[model samples]
Target: MEALKDYLPHSVEGKNILITGGTTGIGRATALLLARLGANVMITGLDEQHLKDALKDLYKEAKGEVYDVIADLSTEEGVNATFRTADSHFDKLDILINNAALPAGKVENGSYSEWQRVINTNLLAYTACTAQALERMKGDGHIVNIGSMSADVREETGSIYVATKSGIQGFSEALRKEVNKSGIKVTLIEPGAVDTDMQDQPTQEKKEKVENLEMLTADDIAISVLYCLSQPKRCDVVELKVRPHLQII
Candidate 1:
């Protein structure tokens, strides 16, 4: 057992981690797992009730400290407030997970305000959060951006979403090169057909899809995140593309 432990040298225990859009879906799942592993976690969400609820659940399973803040990442002020909460709670940040996002919609059908909200939440917030995280990190940190496979698929339905995700794909690649010299690792996880609130399907239908392997559960993506964090510092899992076995998209 001792020798087998050498396979993964890094550990999340005692590390300080901040996750954006963490009240529901993948972000919540990731926070729960990290908290269980003894990492101090700070989660940001837009809803006050949702934040309270998520914090209650997180505290139940967490070994290290758990905190939550109300944040609307679509605006600049919200992003600043979120990190200020992080600064007050944690002494330093070891990991940053950019997971907050809005649902997809066609660019042509939506109002300008709608498109702006989506862009700011999905793409711009990730970049802004990275900048804030970088300031707090003292070398040897990790940043995980939760992107989507829609970037590559480029389907007809959600052109705006595809744009932001595609931007993330390029942004992650470039950011990795920029941050690597500073000993900070950047990873992009692009998931396909995840059964989360983002999907408008009925609850039962989504459950059936997951059962049939047509869709992935939020927990599945959380496990992938844990895998990336547990690797040795010398190894950087740059990009991870995860899809369900039967998911065509």
Candidate 2:
């Protein structure tokens, strides 16, 4: 007569969590939900105004502490600054959600600087953040990486983006194995066609697509992230691929 709840061993309450690109989209939704669940949430963003705006909303429902840092994750100095700020506020780390990213064009369409920006922001930042988090996470922390379906689909005219996503997919797999023995769990949550700022569509158009089940909301992916985090230590929800029911690709 063992209930399903008996197997759910993890609880986010009081855990210190760090989320990047949390000013909007999936990262914002995840931060808000976790804050309401009584977790100490720290969010980062590139824009100071955006960081302030997100913190304003997070504190509205937050039961535990909530903090924000404004940093450009594409650079090494920025990554170091993010962790330094986190250390000042939180004594230790419990969860790291690598959700920061950007949209990109084809390799030939953009300049070398643009390509570097995309790669640094979308791919290298995840690895850099994980390294910093691993130092703070003694043995039993969770690292949730927000990859994309682009890794699998590899759509045309999106070679630059595909490259970064593909890198993340491989990075997450290797990271999981490397951290497995340390009791650290790594979960890769890949979402498809989410109606976020990254989407090149009007808000109403995006809503219509969502209503038609052709696209998903940020909250949809947030719930998936929460599910992966709430699993028992013995049960790792390794890779979760979330797509809208009617999304063609």
Candidate 3:
């Protein structure tokens, strides 16, 4: 923790960062933290109100710049529009965090349309946003992809969600290898059962479901995001899997 606080802004201050699904939950938490730490943050979500709400507390704590883009992010146009919105606000970019995602669907008996919706939102849009962000990156940048434990575990309820997340892990790994020479780092941040909208907070019963460990707050995941970006330029924190201590994966 002292190292993190001391390393502080090796080059982070005034850096422009893009975060998808930043309206609420983990994305929002990460955005606020980066902003407080002196980075210029741009966030995207479908809800303008939620975006405002997310910024409410952050605005109070920080003095850095932050922008919000209202984008559906499930369609090609939405993805493009989000990039455009960020481009309009900032001239250069440094970080791209793919934090937005879609819900899971039952694959076996699910409708084809439902499957397409899930894949299109989770898989296709992530690709589109990454490509567009890369095009706008001024120099070497960071791409932090939020992946899932469900990708490796049994996502009995969310089969499609699991598939895309698994594919995301692969995509990030391949992209990291391809871009390593450029000094651009691509990392997959796989977290399990965070206390966010993507997963409900543990009920009294669910909390009891685990013995000693507590649930993961969005801030916990935010710290992980910071840790990745805080690494020295020559070293990359490629893949970080953060699960509650009691939940062994």
For each of the candidates, the C-alpha root-mean-square deviation to the true structure, in angstroms, is 1.6, 1.5, 2.5
Taking the tens digit of each residue's C-alpha lDDT, what string does model 3 give over 1-249? 346555655546788899999888889899888888888888888877897898787677655788888888878888888888888888877899998887776777678877887788788888888888788775689989999888789568877788899889889989988877876888899988777766654456444543456457788899999889888777789999998887777
* CA lDDT of every candidate: 0.92, 0.93, 0.82
Task: Give all TM-scores, in the order shown.
Answer: 0.97, 0.97, 0.91
Model 3's lDDT to the true fold? 0.82
Angstrom error at residue 163, model 1: 0.4
Model 3's C-alpha root-mean-square deviation from the true structure amounts to: 2.5
Worst 10 residues of 1 by lDDT: 1-10
lDDT of 2 by residue, 98-132 (tens): 99999997877989998998899999999999999
Error of 2 at 93 (Å): 0.7
Misplaced by over 4 Å in model 3 are 1-6, 9-11, 200-214
